[model samples]
Target: MQKTKLKALTKILGQTALIALITFVMSEITLRIYNKINPSFVFYDSSYNRFRGKPNAPDYDFKLNSQGFKDVEFTVEKPAETYRILGIGDSFTYGVVPYQYNYLTVLEEKLNKSGQKTEVINMGIPGMGPRDYLSILVNEGLKLNPDRVVLSFYIGNDFLDNYMTANLRTEEKSYMIALIKSMIKIQSNYKGKVLNPTTVQYNDNLPTFTDEKYLEDTINKSNMFVRNPADGMFKGFVDDAVKDLIKIKQICDSQNIPLTIVIIPDEVQVNSQLQKQVKQAFDPNNQNLLDFEISNRLLTEQLQQANIDYLDLLPDFKATAQKTPLYKPNDTHWNIAGNRLAAELITQHLTAKNQP
Candidate 1:
């Protein structure tokens, strides 16, 4: 009786293993074919110590160029009448919306419409900061021989992002894993877009965003207001950001190229009501703990000292934020309106610069 029972158990186990194997293979095959049709996932690049979009992949439906950047294929030689501006930064510069809706694209159209031929090559990548910017500038930006450079600096969590770039980890190369990650990221992004799902968190030690949309990513993006326990660093993050920019300045200076900065403010800074909510969350007794201008003012001072030209969008954004929804409902990025506003403002700035 015992031998018969053992034989039956062994058969059951073998059948279960076979079923799991078949399911995995089928799923893998399906994913492979699906990816071929619509390839849009980022892969870890050991050489650059960053995640680059797959060549020719339509990442976020914004088709990447041959070089993996979300811009048109650029020639090393500049056209005689065409002026090229190389735009670089983190996600803000990468843009969440489609390529057509991106501010850089709008800026280019505006420039060209105004009778000056221009091309804005976007070198933005999501989850990147100062360290990554430096590497990209050295490796790729200079090679294109751009006439000008425009850097987008987001005040929200760029300082934190800058400091955290030190902690880089190698992601496992797995198709299934990459697919799941892409799905989760896209789903989370859509959930808050045009909707306010990312409510403020009260925990002082925890990251500001407690919503499921940003929970997985919150640990890394600590803004000026919140002091994430894991990092045990915030103020220094500001200094480190400026430090990196100074280095970028030195490089541009050596080449005799001009660099301009566009300061992108955090949503909390623009949304007055959100300010109250975050204040209450952190410390109701001291509602003024979160100062919106702290990050901007600090960075502004450094840029001025370095003689760097900048266009701070915070004032204009705050002025019209209540009148219109400049940012996505709960997300940190600029909505369509905000992007348009940025393009218009940049148009005024650039046109004025070329006036003389």
Candidate 2:
């Protein structure tokens, strides 16, 4: 009787194991098919030391080219009479909007309409910083033989991103974790959240210009240099970023490519109401609200000292904000109007430079 019962138990355990194996295989197959159909995937790039979008990903209306850039396809060899401009930076340059709506694309359209043969390649990668930009330029940007390079330096959290690059670790996700996260994302969408559920929801009752708690939180989230924890490490990050910029300039100079740095300011910097709120929140006594501009001034000064050409967009953005909203209502990134203005400004600057 004991031997018979032991045999039955063994049979039960074998059935369980087989079922699990079959389930895992089915899940793996389904995931691969889903990924192929909806390629919203980002994978770790060992060479660049960061995560990059998958090549040829059909993510929404935007499609990444074979080179993992969020732009149309192009060969390594430049076409005759076609001037290529490589736009490099973080998400602002990469853009979250449709491909044709991005600033680089708009700039290209305006340039071509003005009778100049131009192709602006969007080399922007989301969540990258100065170090990643340098790595990308060395490893990929130069290989395309661009005639000019524009670095869109977004002053929002670049210093913080640069500082954090020192501690960046390789992304590792287990199959089980991925499955769970995917399910959670689906459930979040079902509950009316957007496709990407990483957005922050602010309190409804908070005043725009006077709520201390909300303003403080916004400052901490929006301006990395002004955050309390960044006090001791701010200068170090700025120095590191400056060194990387110099390296980028050196690379561009060697290839005889004109490198232009375009300074993109944060929404708070241009929004008067937000600025007032931040000052009240952080400096009730009106002590030092200008501390956030320190990083911008430092970078500008460094560019001047290095004799590098840079266009500060703060004044223009501020001026434009008086008449229109350049940024999204709640998000940090620029809206369609903002991209249009940026493209217009960049076109004017470049057109002037190319004049006889």
Candidate 3:
């Protein structure tokens, strides 16, 4: 009886192991194909303080270069008579739209179209902040010998992004496990909300963004805009962000590379209609509760003191926000129109300096 039972147990164990192996192989194959359509783009690396793109991740639309960034592979030896600008920032710089529609791409095309040979390298990574920008510049940016560095500072959550990165858990290294986790997380989050390149593929159509809960959450989450960066509820994040920005400037100056900080304004600060809604939901009675431009004013003040050459896009964006759709509905990042506007403005500014 004992011999018979032992043999039966061994047979069961072997069957289970075979089944598990088959399941793992099938799951890996499925994930690899899914990644082809919407790549599992960015990952948290032990080597860096922030999230970076998955190297050579090619989706249906765009491919991250060999360096794990949105732009093409960059060689340290820049071509002669070619001007290269290292574009830096978070998702806005990494881009939520198609690759060709990003401001960096548009800016490069516009500059080249006007007869000046220029290469605008997109060094932007999603979920990055001032500190991450500084890190990338130190690690890979300076080696490229860029002529200029234009760092795009989004007003929405850069300060918050900088602060929260310290607490985020690193993602799994295994592709199948990572993809499974990513899918589960995406489904758990609000519907129609695009989080990362891995979550959703870029499209020309806008998302269904009328989820009031998402709007309220976005307001409370990004409410740092309602006060001065120095004295507000988000003082710690603001201070940390500023210190990193100053360090970035110092590094660029040390290398004799001109750094231009492009301040991308938040939509709440610029949109009065949205402000009314925010006021009602967030502060029912106070008309003056939200101070939209205070963040821009305070941040720019620090930049001026540091003598950092900066471009405040608030005015231009405000002037154009209503007439043109700058931000995607309910989403903090810019849509296609917003990208085009920024490209146009930056191109005008850059070209204005060289024109006779």
Segments of candidate 3 deviating more than 4 angstroms: 1-50, 168-184, 190-202, 208-210, 227-231
The true-versus-predicted C-alpha distance at residue 335 of model 3, in Å, is 1.2
Candidate 3 per-residue lDDT, tens place, 1-356, comes to 99999999999999999999999889877766765554544333333433566777764367788877888777889988889899999888987777888999999999999886888999887777787888889988899898899999988888777666676554465566776777776766546644344556766555545557556766786567554444555766767888999999889988888888999987776777877778787778876767778778878988999899888999998988778778877677788999999999898888776720
Clashes of 1: 0
Whole-model Cα lDDT of every candidate shown, in order: 0.73, 0.74, 0.78
Q: What TM-score does each of the candidates earn?
A: 0.74, 0.74, 0.78
Q: Root-mean-square deviation of each candidate, in angstroms?
A: 7.4, 6.8, 6.1
For candidate 3, give the lDDT of residue 241. 86
CA deviation > 4 Å runs, candidate 2: 1-51, 168-217, 221-232
Task: Compare candidates 1 and 2 on lDDT and give the better one.
Answer: 2
**Model 1, runs deviating above 4 Å:** 1-49, 59-62, 168-223, 226-232
Best by lDDT: 3
lDDT of 2 by residue, 1-356 (tens): 99999999999999999999898778767755665554433322223423456678654556688877788998889999898999999989877556776899999999998886888988888888888889888888899999999999888877677655455443223343465665665564333222222243422222233244445556685444364443556667667788988999999999999999999998888898887777776668854644556667878988999989898888899988988988755556777788889999998888889820
